[model samples]
Target: MKKETGLRWLFFFAGLMVLGLGAALTIKGQRFGVGSWDVLHIGLFERLGLSIGLWSIIMGLIVITIASIGLREFPKIGTFINMTFVGIFIDFFNWLISDSNTFSVQLIAFIIGVLLLAMGSGIYISAELGAGPRDSLMLLIVKKTHFSIAAARTIMEVVVAVAGYLLGGPLGIGTIVIAFALGPIIQVTLKYSGKLLEKSVKVESVAHGHG
Candidate 1:
C-alpha cells in the first residue's frame, strides 16, 4: 500500500514538472501563443512587475477561491500543489529554454510542448490525485450551469483568451492549435496511461498481499 501510494506521488510530481516544462516552451516560443489561461497569465505578468510563475500562482488562487465560493468546496492537497509547484517549475524551465532563436526551432518546441502537456495531464489524472485548480473551477461551472463539459470549457477559454488579448497577450496559431488539438491529445494519452496505471496498481497490490 505504501509503495503504491509513493509511486502515485512520484508520478504526480513528475507529470507536473513535465507539464511546466511544456508551458515554458510554449511561452518562450513567442511566435505562437500559449493556451487560453496561460495567455491571461502572460498578460498579467507583462502589465504587472512579477515573474510569469508568480502571475500563474496568483491567478490560480483567484480561480480556486472563486470555485470554493461557487461550489462551497474545499480544494485537495494536490490542487494546492498543482497551483503552486507547477508555476515554480514553469519559471525554472523558462529560464533554461528561453533562447531558441529560429522560427522552425520555436515551432517544433511548441508542438513538442503541447504533447508534453497532454502526457503530463494524463499521468497526473492516472495518479488519481485531485484535479488542478483550473480543472476544479471548470467542473464547478459545469455543475452549476448544467452545461456540458465542452461548452463550459469553451466559454471559459473564450472569455479568458479575449481578456488576455486585450491585455496584450499573444493570440496566434499556437493558441488555435491548443484549442483544437489538446482535447484529442489528452484523450489518447489518458486512454493509454490509464491502462498502465491500473496494471501497476494491481501488480503492486498482488505483490504486497503475497509479501
Candidate 2:
C-alpha cells in the first residue's frame, strides 16, 4: 500500500512538472495556451487595478461554487488546492515580470510562469486529489448536456474566451492557439497517464492476489 501510494505521488508530481513545462513552452511559443483563460484573467485584473493573484482566487472560488452546485460529488481538497496554488504561482510569476528590467527578461519569466502553471496542474491532477473546479464544471456540463467531454470542454472554453475578450482580457495568438489545442493535449495526456495508472494498479492487484 505504501509503495502504491508513493508511486501515485510520483506520478502526480510528474504530471505537475509536465504541465508546468507545457505552460512555459506555450508562453515561449508566443502563442495562447490551449485555454488562454488565464491570459484574459491576468489582463483584466491589470486593467481593473486589482492584483491578478487576488482575481485568480476570486475566480477560482466562483468556479468552485459553480462546481459544487453542478457536481456535488467532486472532491473539495483538489478544488481548493487547484485554486489556491494557481493564484500563488501566477502572483509569483507576475512579480518576476514586474521586477525584470527588460521585455526579454519578462518574456523569459512569462515562459517559466506558464511552465510552472502547467506542471502544478498536471501534478495535482495525477494525485487524483480531486478534479479542478473548471474540470468539474466541464464534467457537469458533459453529464447535463449529454455532449462528449471534448465537445463540452471546447464549448465552455470558447464561451469563456469570448467573454474574457469582451471584458478586456488578453485574447491574442496565445489564446487562439490554446483554444484549439488544449482539448487535444489534455486528451492525450490524460489517456497516457490513465493507462500508466491502470497498469500500475493491475500490478499491485496481482501481487496482492486480487488479480
Candidate 3:
C-alpha cells in the first residue's frame, strides 16, 4: 500500500513537471495554444486589459465550482495541485523565459513545451488522484450528453479556442496543434501508464499476501 501510494505521488510530480514544460512550449510556439480558453484570455488581456494569469485563476475556480456541482466530487489533491501549481509554473516560466526574441530560441522553446505538456498531462492523469477540474467538467459533459470522450473533449476545446480568439488570447499554430493532438497524446500516455500502475499494484498485493 505504501509503495503504491509513493509511486502515485512520483507520477503526480512527474506530471506537474511535464505540464510546466508544456506551458513553456505553448508560449514559445509563438502561437496561441490549441484551445479557445487560451485564445480568449489572450484576447481579453490584449484588448480589455485583463490580467491573463489572474483571470486564469478565476476561471479555474469557477470550473472547480462547476465540477463540484455537476460531478459532485470534492476537490482532490490532484485538483488542488493542478490549480495552484500550474499557475505558479506558468508565471515562473513566463518571467524566466520571456526573452524569446529569436526564431531559433522560440522554436526550441516550443518543442520543449509541447513535449513537457504531453508528458506532464500523461503523468497527472495516470495518477488517478481525480481528474483536474477542467477535465472533470469535460467528463461531466460526456456523461450528460452521452458523447464520446474524444468528441466531448474536442468540442470543448473548439469552444474554448473560439472564445479565446474572440476575447483576444494568443491564437496561432500552436493552438491548432494542441487542439488536435492533446487528446491523443493524453490518451496514449494514460493508457500505457495505467497498465504499468495496475501491474505494479497487483504485484504488490500478491507479495503482501505471501508475506
Q: Highest lDDT: give the candidate number.
A: 1
lDDT of each: 0.82, 0.61, 0.72
TM-score of 1: 0.92
- lDDT by residue (96-149, candidate 1, tens digit) is 875777899888888888889878877786787776777778779889999865
Which runs in model 3 stand beyond 4 Å of their true positions?
32-35, 47-53, 199-211
Alpha-carbon runs more than 4 Å astray in model 2: 17-34, 93-126, 200-211
Q: Cα deviation in Å at residue 51, candidate 3?
A: 5.5
Worst 10 residues of 3 by lDDT: 29-38
Arranged by lDDT, best first = 1, 3, 2
Residue 95 local lDDT, model 3: 68
- For lDDT, candidate 1 versus 2, the one ahead is 1
Clashes of each: 0, 20, 19
All models, RMSD in angstroms: 1.7, 4.4, 2.7
